[model samples]
Target: MTAHFVQVANAERLAADVMADVMTPPPPVDYLRWAEDNIIFTERESPLPGPYNRDLFFYFDEILRALSPDDPCRIVSVHKSAQLGGTVLANIFCGGSLAMDPGDFLYVHPTENNAQRWSKMKLVPMLKGTPALTKLFPMKARDGSDSVLYKERIDGKGAIQISGANSPASLSQVTMKRQVQDDLSKWEMNNAGDPETQADSRSQAHEFAKILKVSTPLVDPGCRITKSFEDGSQEKLYLPCPQCGHMQTLEWENFLANLDEDKPENSHFVCVDTECGGVIEEHHRPAMFKAAKLLELNGVEVWRSENPKAKRFHRSFHLWSAYSLLQSFERIARAWLNARGDPASEQTFFNDVVGRAYKTLGEAPPWEGLRDRAAKSDHPKGRIPVGFPIVTVGVDCQADRVEFQVVAWGRDYRRAVVDYGVFPGHISTKECWAFLDGLVRQEYANGYGRKIGMDLLAIDGNAWTEDVWGWAKRHLSSKVIMVRGVPSESAPLLARVKKERSRSGKLLSYSKRFYNFATSVLKMGLYRNLVKDDPLSRGHIALPRGLDDEYFRQLTAESRRAKRLKTGFIAYEWVKDPAQANEGLDTHLQAEAAAIKFGVRSMPDSMWDRYEADRERPPAEAQYEIEDLMAPGLPYVPPAPAAAPALPTKKLTKAKVRRGKWMNADG
Candidate 1:
């Protein structure tokens, strides 16, 4: 067995040696000679004016050249960059192959417009150009279709046609030697989900047996064309490293490794793979290159030309050569950088193009200014911080315990979770009552001193709703009320009312007034409006300084794609990451909404009637300030003066209230 294994190894080595000896690079074949002997050609100039006169080969002619005498490569998937003469190259390959072996050939592009464009721009021009080719077959733009051509061969005639990727019916009727998918990624809108993308690709694979996919990369890396190249069968066009014989993909990363940073703009590829470290110039490329129309070499599954050992003129090449012809190195470099590599052409190199976006995301949002201003503003002694105007207490109730916080926003719109409550989760109804009484008592004690009112309290209305509301209705007076309904919508209203800015631009009041004022400020568009001192009402205290700071950072770092709506552009907000926005908005919206519905003012009978009348009027006629009607309580009236002079007032002492032992014991 050992001897047999050694003999097999030796035999394999011998065969490899013989193959390498025979694999010497062939001399460059002249285009003119190859055309006469191998390919039938027709040529024409481009309809659009350009530098070179048109002398092109037809699709069938090239197809004929690429296929074998008896059996041909069934499919060719061409992954391509834009332009670069890929379409023309595909045409040449198909035409040359089909011309030799007369068979059906179907061409597919993303859309009908593109199909027609390819027909006019590439297929027709090539057919009309070459003198010998034009005589062999003739084609003209048909009335309803793009173009049609005939291939009269020794055996039989073949037909070539164009079809759109979206038109499945047209594609199903045809079976051909070659299937060409041009820019499949362009079939769908960016950010769309289409099952047809995969369906069409698989269908085409079955029909043509041989697939050629070609496309430019989409904005998203997960595009259909990209997936096909990565996951589908690959006929990788590999070039040999100058220092090593190993074949590896030649990608933008490989290209950038050769760049000379000192001469930043003038850098090119130099093979520096750990083993090679060889600088490969363009002139030496032809000899170092090898072509193998790979079939199922890796996990990729594709139908190869029936004969696996057959080495034919079936070639696939990634021609970055077209870059120099159509666009500048800078333009291509930027696009290349955007794909995987960093852009090298811009003034700041990486930073100017990519770094700026990074910087923006890294920086804080402008709203941070409002947070700082709100935080820094002075408040009356013992009050919740001046920044905390509208305070919404969120309570999580359990059988034994109730947990809550008085989140206060200052007059400037800054907010904070000022206090919290957590009792036994298994507490009884009496205990729950005690918990409620203690919370209100503590709030009144701290809040009245600061002169900052506790605007609203939102309990978990999802559970224990009846218990919480009933407890509040029985024990709590009009001094404060538990906010009911959806906190997400109500908290903001309360926060808006409590928000206030002083004449000098500093937040002054920590009342329901502040919440109202803040909403008005936001309504006027706080993000865009730059205050003289605050500059962009971001400094408005609607949220806590800490939250506001982070929120601002997120807002500035992110970009919004404002979509056009019937009325105006709806700026769908974006955070750099999904997690941040999800965590923040729930708290912000709920807290803000809670503030809106809390501490609502009562109106007088006459004023109420008038407001009702105005509300009944057409919205156009309802011009009165809605603010006044929404304020708490009936209108004020003055008391009549006494007839005689009043006695001088005297201050009452604590002795009066604690006149007896009972009052002293209670105190």
Candidate 2:
């Protein structure tokens, strides 16, 4: 009876101890402390294979502190250069969170293949090396809990989910408490929507959720990481000059100011402080970083721009290669020197080394400049310029009117705008169709006394597909074809013709063909050509006189811009304001497509010579009459009068004719 009483008392004591442990709160998770105490680097992952040392990259301390569970900052963004320990910081956060604050964690990459590669090459090595993480997530053979995409704790407290931003399925099915997005700027959209936003929504149920975003920026205005950095407290790391003791952010300009190309090793950073005017050498970086830490403790190393939208809970940091321990000033200077002449290489240097977005060449030229230049044009509207052999027309069908642009193509891809106008009537009406029919059949006289007929005509069928297709069927012999604009940036300038199918999924007997051209690609090429000032250069465009300012405004209305579609996909396309009209631009794209269809892009000099020879010959007897081309029940509308008098029909030598300029009367 005494033994049984002792057993009962012991059992009661055990139950009380269990209750006390359950009621006690777990200690706050200090991310930096946990990382330093637990994480171990492997030879495969790091150059220094040992216990994690914060002193090596002391600049990461503030960012690491922001990721702690006790910190109020829920979103921590880092815009950094390539080898600045950004990836290491992410891994540390993942390892620390899994070990100390057991909760569902997520790690996202740009693509599924990237995620798999990172899991095998990066995550596995860290897990195997770190003893504390191994205990939580043991990788046993045939273990159901441990897999390539997921790793769950043995205690059932939490798990780590690996996913790709391009795969919507993996990101949608699970809820995560802490998430890390690597290379956020490279994340592409999936069918489910923007992967970043979708991943963020998974953690909305947790009030104290933590999100860490890290990336090297891409193009300006379109870079996702840049946008996030701007939305947060734009904190820039400032290191003090050893000589002046004045703090300044490490800027590329300051580094370049004193760089010697022949001897890059002699390069030094110039202190921007007006009073000090000190020159700092590379050896002073270590001491400067240490000084910056002391200044940080005194609330001075990091500074934020005045942004009202920035919240205390969101902290962001920006760093470049100059701050990286692995990168030297000489190496960065050499990279800049190598990338001096090439735009592509320069862009890479800016994005990967400088940690800044590169401004692309797709920006629109100043409309005022183009307008002022057009006023000095020697050719007049309604007449083909001298030496141009091929003429094509582009039509834009709208609800109220149909806009058209006539372009003449010459050798070396030089082009001139002959005429542009609008037929003010509903596109579906026969009257509007009649006007277009007459224009297509009309002939324009050139300065060489040659009447040039259009080789091909392209009509935009994106709005009224059926009507445009019907009209195209009637003019099949005249090379009048229907076209649609493709939204993709990588699509070809002009795609192969696609046969139209009926709603019942049957191919039509007529074998009607339509073309789809990449609008983004064509517009990019057009903008690049528009900025060329030399008249003799290839792709130079000549604008005829009498073109109004409104025409130029319409031509320059749309600029390449980054926009988020309804599906949450961010794309760079030609976008214009609601108040601006871009019909002229659309017709110009269509005209270029029509020129491509006429084989002008690949046309040899012999073919151009034949066209030039044909212009000197008499008119063909098989030309279609204006009455035969007019729409039924519509009155005949005469073509506009010539802008200039016809030149004498004197035969001239090919050498005497200016390829893309006004000809002298002596010719």
Candidate 3:
């Protein structure tokens, strides 16, 4: 009886001791370091599964540390290119929040679809694959405790609700201690003007609420994320040159190695230091990463600084592809080389690849800028200039007449308006289209002697859609296409291509292909081309001398005006001046559309060289016989018949021409 009483007392005491120990908080540890030790890369979904490699991601150590609970700063903005270990930062942040400071976390994406995709591709895989995380956030779809859009920690007062920027109500309803907004730049506009006000409203309850904003950045400074990036401390990554040991931010201009043109892949990069221009080979990246450091720029450098004030509490960083271990200098150089001349592509290179906003395309050209640069051509209106290879035709339909132009394209996208005129017939009549066909079939002899014919034709099918559609069916070929304008301001110069259907609802036999080209983007390209200081730039137009002043007036008729969006963002559009006609501008834009569809931009130099070599030689004179000229009444002379060579008696060394058939020949 005495032993049993003692055992029960000891068991109770031991249980009490265990409960006390469970209440004790875990010791402080670096959140990033802890993640590196525990987080598994997940082999089923990721090739790199295991403990995180701190050396590979050493640069992020300071940024992640500042996001830790120990840090005083409550907000952080990571403006960067995609797939540069930004997700790893997100993972470690969530893991730390769950383990130490247990509370709600809201992961926001650009849209509902984006949120769902990230949960499936990133969140779920991350939890199920990592043993450490799997224990904390186990999957249980049936119980409603764990789901794709929401999750509750199995052992803590922690939960995560994933939502999109579009759902502002959801963002405000659920208060979270930490908000992870991935791709913040892509968030859709809200009725309230800014989605940030609604989303940030949720975090008002917590004093130390963490707001993490990450994005690749969009064009407009009015974009929510771009504005945020400017407001925060602008931090940049700098690396010591492996060769010269001079610290510098690696920019696209510093290292230019691929001017050789033919073998672009062999492009190289070097240090920017003029005194020590040293080759920075691929192998030197590891050392560069080791020496990499982040420098926070002053307020003056931030985009659109008002009073040189940067948010003291928020940490913002901007890193380019140059510092990315996965990206190479050669790869970035090649992308720049291809994107240099064209605004859309060049902007893409700046925004997506380098994670920097592109410079504004600039203002419209002065009306006389291109007019002064016009090439003096001796060839007449119907003739193609020397060195011009391919020709494209642009046709515009109107109520009274059809305006058409023949534009010749050469290497470097050099354009020549060889011929243009008004067809004196209404679009509703058959004569207008017939005149178009006649112009298409007409060939012009170029200065190089090459018989130049239109390689591609694009006709605007804006008004009189039915008439244009019917006419396109009869005239459409591999080289001919109909273009309909899509007023989508954000779309590229070429938006979507599809096949046109006849009245019977079946695809047409000829010219079935139709393109929904964005007029706004094309106009932007046109304006940018005209504004080029160098005549050699792509999209530059060389007007022939014969064109009258009225043609010039029509060509420069359109001027760009900024159109304000509902969200207060500025969008520029080409508005026609009421005083001048824009038919000439439309023709040139359509001609460019035709050239783009024909793949002239992608044509190889060797193919262009072959085109350059061919000359338009005149057709040879017809061969004629003397009998054709001689009259049939003329009498033949006997001496002429006797002049025929005598038959050889001996075996001839060489065969002699004989009129007799093989069977009748001498045996």
Candidate 4:
């Protein structure tokens, strides 16, 4: 007892002093200064090795300062391309946390494989190179104590865990003071829930937790990083033009006029400032980077939300490849040269190189091009050309009448519009049914001088469901089918058919059943094909001369718009014009659906090669010859008059005539 303590009457004072010392909090640390002083960059892990140099990447200094424990923001958002050194910045924050503000921290990638690769190629090298970081984790690789997925702090009270957005279970357990998410665009979408919302839950337990998110922009309209960036004080890095001294965000658009696809090496970049008209040179970038400033909006800027009051507790930054020191203007021009003609490459250049979301067209291409491409052939508006081996028909069932388009298909997926016609009359009436019977039964001259009837027909059954069911039951055959459009953007262009019972409750027995498709997918394909089609390329659809501006406008009636989802990703949806009709779009999509039903897209390359070889030979010498088949003759069909008759819109005249433009003159 004497050795332990003297039992004095005033011993309470000593106990009170000890408690106060234990309760006092540690002093605030300067995160950016500490990173520069203590952090190490390995040759294997970083381009600039040894002590972390702040001057090399001045843009990241302010970012780290905001992430410091003393900063008011609990979340940090980073919207960037791969060239912006976002990956290195994330590693620096984690390293700083390990040294100064240690607590449970998390590093997440889009997938487990990505996380593991980053851990080994980046994290391990970083830790091994830095003395302070190395002391935090086990040194020996053989030490079964820690794996690539986890690094335990020597204190054991904290850890740095590596996880993937795809792994729900692994992401759930950790309660962290800091979390860093990289390549968020690549994260798998959770059907049952959102991976991001779930990941955000981990930091819920911490009072001053920090969240950092980074990624290159994807074309997706509802992309996660966009929302993350919007949640903060949206900041853009503004650098003065090397020549003009006029300040602006660097963009590829500034280089477009100087781009020479034919000679990318000689291509140049010019300043957009009209007053300066300066050509940007490779040597001018260093000074530009040095002078670059991360700018916040002044409340009235173009992106209005950049206003002060709009900002939340998070700080967001957008960095573009235009500011990348490693890339040269010539290199950027070269990349555009390789991407110019290809859709996929173009998207990549815009997303990865320029750092922007893929733009989906809300406005159709100028009509003048389509109108110019349309030249009158020997074939009339409704006549099939001799080259098309198969003719398919699609009917759009409107409330008053059925509008239809006929398409001609060849061996190479090359197509021509055989006809566009409007069949007027109530679809439920016998006269309308009679008109339909006449259209499907009519024959058109194939290029080989033989007559060919439609091999497949897909009627729009989405509307007038029961009426369509009755019609399908009457005309249900291998050649005649019904189709419905799916709303999902990701659904396949052509989905597997689901069998349905006839009006008599009889199940359709064949595997080739209803032709249901994703209209959205088909529209995207059509839009891309319209814009990217090179006359020399395959799978091009030619518009006939007789198609007026109204037809083309109707075909392009729907414009695509970017819609943000709750997940912070964007999806493109077709918005119909109040002034125009989508009858042209609907009919064309159905025809495309019919072609898919004919297994045109799925034909084996060998089969296609054989078909191509055979198409070159004379019809007589061809092994696979399309039969000059005509369906059984229908009752007397009348030629459609040039103008609409005086009949009421709702009235049907079956006895007077089965009137339709689709009827063949010879019939």
Candidate 5:
């Protein structure tokens, strides 16, 4: 009951608590034999709750152990679905590494809020609830500090630093041997502008590059995380094939889309070489299946954990299923849109969830046999070859180059990029007009002696449009060339163009059928035909390349606006700035696209007569109706009154009275 006795009793309890927190010995197992055979972690965590499974656990554990001590960093990029225990596995690696080696380890999330949430929801609960795990170290509640340090466990200094992407300064201060990025894509830039460019460059530039990058795919191909995963220079996780026994790493190129209809999908693979036909099928290994199938790739150790039978142990681990479910459909749609700029998937995933509406890529443009046609002008013949109806000249212009497509239409269809000029350094408006005049002279030789129904000659209004417009007005007649207004905001128009791009890439332009020749060429993809071989189709199909960045932006915008109908045609709108949308080029390109839209591809100068004729004819649909009624009250008659009007007719009146014979009697 004395103070001294109370102190002694408190000391005894403290000693007992300390004694309980020690790492216990491993059960009788042949570590030596297991090492020799190299077969380890076999027991399903399902079969024995707490026992070590060498065949399963050792596969990943050995990898962690195999790294060089000085440069001990591994970046594992994982693409997974729900129910894979990759999170727990990641946590296990984090905890185990700190336990085995005394050093700092940081777990970086995309945001501070996420870091706090993970610590509260996963880390704190796991460490506190697991009695067996807690016994390995002294634990304490989190103070204001961002890290939870496990004091001096196994002569290895252990501490876990938790940080969000925003706290780069704090994250940089930590000198850690290992860093784990959990779902880096989710921590994107909330602000405007390019998210990829806004990401923390110092992380990779300093040390995080040497660590691990782990996440699901994102919507943007240009995303920082996606770019990092796609980078070929980095050492990716590769696994030895059970068949050929050769090692291979997973790549997006290896994935076969729509391979599975249910949970636990399989991947189909051939030899990495373009020529080899060797096949490899990747499925759930027994040990891997036993752990939890979060996601699997060749040789990547990305697996999650499952619920333990014991409540304490169950509560101690984070299930991958929970994390996977957190991935919203918005995220998936975003990823789909990112991987390919097609917005058809955006509508399906985000709006209706019906399905991807169009091809992953845009439609194959109508193959305009660039090579052979480039040699000499080729004109498809049917009608008059020389003098025909009015002629409409359709030209398409680009920034550095101007494509003068002279589409002469009648009974005959003649099209040619007659004058191709690649201008330098954004030429002046006078130069542009001069160039246009030159093209006309070179192609038509006296303008072909016909009136040209010119479409819009969109000049660079944003830059040097005034000069170009002035020159154009001075040189060309109002009847010969009319420039249309092109609005600066063309995002909506671009969206429409993107939506109708073919899924199978049929020889077509924006859901419109290409002429039969072009269609036939496209059907026989990437081939050298004996006759009328289409080089553009062949080259485009045979060697797919990323579109130009500016063009890609335009395509993406167009795709977003595209509306797919049950009628098998994609409806879209095209808006180009009349003054400056098509680089510094003239209105020819704009005119051509407009001509195509109007379904007037080729017509001679005489064809301009059609518009005049149309103007003279009465419009087909015009009529109106009116209410029928007579004037109110007796059909509306006016009463007249006598006055001075009789004075003027006095003589006539006297004559009329004499006829009655009364005048003779009065006389």
Candidate 6:
């Protein structure tokens, strides 16, 4: 009986020891130290798998420290490029927070699919690889505390919830102490409003709550991350020159001077300091990064704010691929070289490599400036300019009236607006149609004293499709055609002609074909051309002296805007105020489309010379027939047969046959 009592006493002592150990609080440690000692990188997630190394990403040290619970900063914003370890730093902070300072953590992505992808490819691997995180989330089938999107600590101190910015429900219904917003710039607004604000509201209940926002910027005016970064203490990494000790940010312009196109690997950075223009090689990047300091625009260290008593809650940092060890100078140089002359590719380089927003070229020029420039132009209205070989017309049909713009095309896509006017009658009436037909049939004199007929006339069929189509069918002998505008930005200037089909899916022989043109693409092109100051430059638009201020306002009525769609993707569209009229802009776009369809964009110099020679021909001599000037690549249209004598019965050589056809090419 005494032995059994001793056994029970020993068992009770052992149980007390286990209970005491479980109840004891963990030792105090900052987020940086905790992350370095506890975090592990799996092979699938990291290039340098195994243990987390602070030295490899020394630039992230200050950022990581700012995320600590002890730090006064409640918000950390990282405006960074891809492959710069920004996302990895975010992951480290989250892991450290869950293991060291237990709290209800929330992770938000741009979309549900993005959340699922990051959870499966990133979160699970990270948690399973780290011993500290695995202890909290065993990830077993029977473990009620673990899941693909949620994980709970064994001690029941806190849990993590993963969600997407697109789902309003996921961003609400729970209060979180820590939140991470990945790709915040790409987040879209839900039915409830801005996803960023919705997700941030969840953390309002906790006084010491923490939020980390990270993303590469998009366009400047609409980027959410850029706004956040500007609101906080804007800090940029400034590396000291090895020779002069002058601190400077690594700018792309300075690097371009030393970039060897033949051998990009030999590229180096030149110090921007005027007195100390030292050449810094790529090998010196490591030491420079280690000794780098974060400085504001005024050259003051960010950490050493002037007012220490002021409670600054947000800390923002900017990083680019040039500062990252994973990216080489050679790769950046190659990408820049390849992206030249292409706006889309260059935007990607700016966002993903330079970590800056791309200033889009789609912006409209000031209407006042355009009006002033037009007033000073030498060209006159209602007459074609010298050296112009083609004339095209664009018509905008409205319920009350119809607007038309006549444009002359010269070599290299140069344009001169010859005339523009409006007919007051309704488009559905025959009077308006008669006025447009008269304009199309009228011949205008050029500087060389030769009259030229309109090469192509494109009329918008969107408002009165049936009326426009009926008019177009009647003017089939002329160059009149029907066109409609499409919303796609990537569409070509002129899409393929779509033919009408019968109910049996058979092609209708007598059906009229209409073309779809990309309105955004043409409008962007026109706006860019309107700002060109040099008349000799290709794509330069020359305005006649008679254009009024109202014309200029109508021309610049619309402006390009960045809009987020329901799918969380950004789309650029031309938007105008409801009170504004955009008939001038619409007509110009249609005229440009008509010119493109006439093959003016792809005309060769030899063909243009032939047209010029024909214009300079004497009036007595038979001028080259207008019908024979069919645009290259267009279906051959047989011209009217000219009155000619019968050919000789004898066999003709190639030269004689050609001469004979010159008299009647259509025969």
Candidate number achieving the greatest lDDT relative to the actual structure:
2
For model 1, residues 352-467, the per-residue Cα lDDT tens digits are 22211111121224655655654754432123442233456544454445544455543223344443223543323786677666555553222222223445554443355456
Per-residue lDDT for 600 in model 6?
83
Q: Who is ahead in lDDT, 4 or 5?
A: 4
How does model 5 score by TM-score? 0.34
Tens-digit lDDT string for candidate 2 (478-535): 5787778886542466875555677897875333557788776567567767887787
RMSD of 5: 26.2
TM-score of each: 0.38, 0.60, 0.70, 0.58, 0.34, 0.60
lDDT of all the models against the reference? Answer: 0.41, 0.78, 0.68, 0.69, 0.35, 0.75
RMSD of each: 23.6, 13.1, 16.4, 11.7, 26.2, 13.3
- lDDT by residue for model 3 (1-667), tens: 4554433458777889999889887667477767876676757534555678766666576678768767666778887766677787887787667766778998888778788998898887777766667788867646887877888998758888999888766676688899888887666665555566667778889998888888876555434556776778766656677877776666556555433366655556667789998877667878776555322222222122232245457777776676666776667777877887887676677777878765554345666655655545444555676657788988888766677778888877676778766655577687776776676676666664345678888888767777876777676466677887765443456644555667788865433467777675566566676666555777566666656555566777776566777655554455777645777778878888888888777889988888776543322442435775475887632111111111111111112112111121244
Query: Which model scores highest in TM-score?
Result: 3
Tens-place lDDT per residue, model 5, 1-667, is 6555333458877888777755454233322222323212223323334433444443334333323243223344433332243455555556555544436666777778777888776776555544433655445434433244223343244567777766545455445566667765455433332222223332344442325555543333222344443441222334434344344443333433423323222334454644444554444233233333222423434422222222211111111111222233234334443323113223223211211111222222223332333334232211112322323443333343333333333222222222222332134445555666654443221122222333333222223434444444554332223223332111111111222333586532312211111111111111212122332321111111211222212211211134444433233323333321222123333433334333443334455566435332222342212221343454422211111111000111223222421122123
Model 4 per-residue lDDT tens digits across residues 1-667 = 3567655666788888888877978656676676777776666656666776765676687677778777778788888766778887887788878777678889989878889999888888778767778888764545544788988777675678999888887787678889998887667555535678778889999888888888887655655687678777887766677776776666567677777778766665677787887877667777876655323223222222354543457888877766676677778888776565444445567777877766545466666676667664445566555446667888888766787888887644567787776666667989888877877787765444345577788888777766765676676577777888875543456765665556797775432456679776567557666654454455566666766565677677787786666866455567887755677789998998998888776566676666445442234522431232333564332222122111112212222122322332223
Instruction: Candidate 4: give the clashing pairs.
Output: 221-569, 221-570, 222-568, 222-569, 222-570, 223-568, 223-569, 223-570, 386-446, 386-447
Q: Worst lDDT window (10 residues) for model 4?
A: 643-652
Candidate 4: segments with Cα more than 4 A from true spot = 1-28, 34-51, 139-145, 260-274, 291-305, 310-312, 362-526, 531-667
Ranking by lDDT: 2, 6, 4, 3, 1, 5
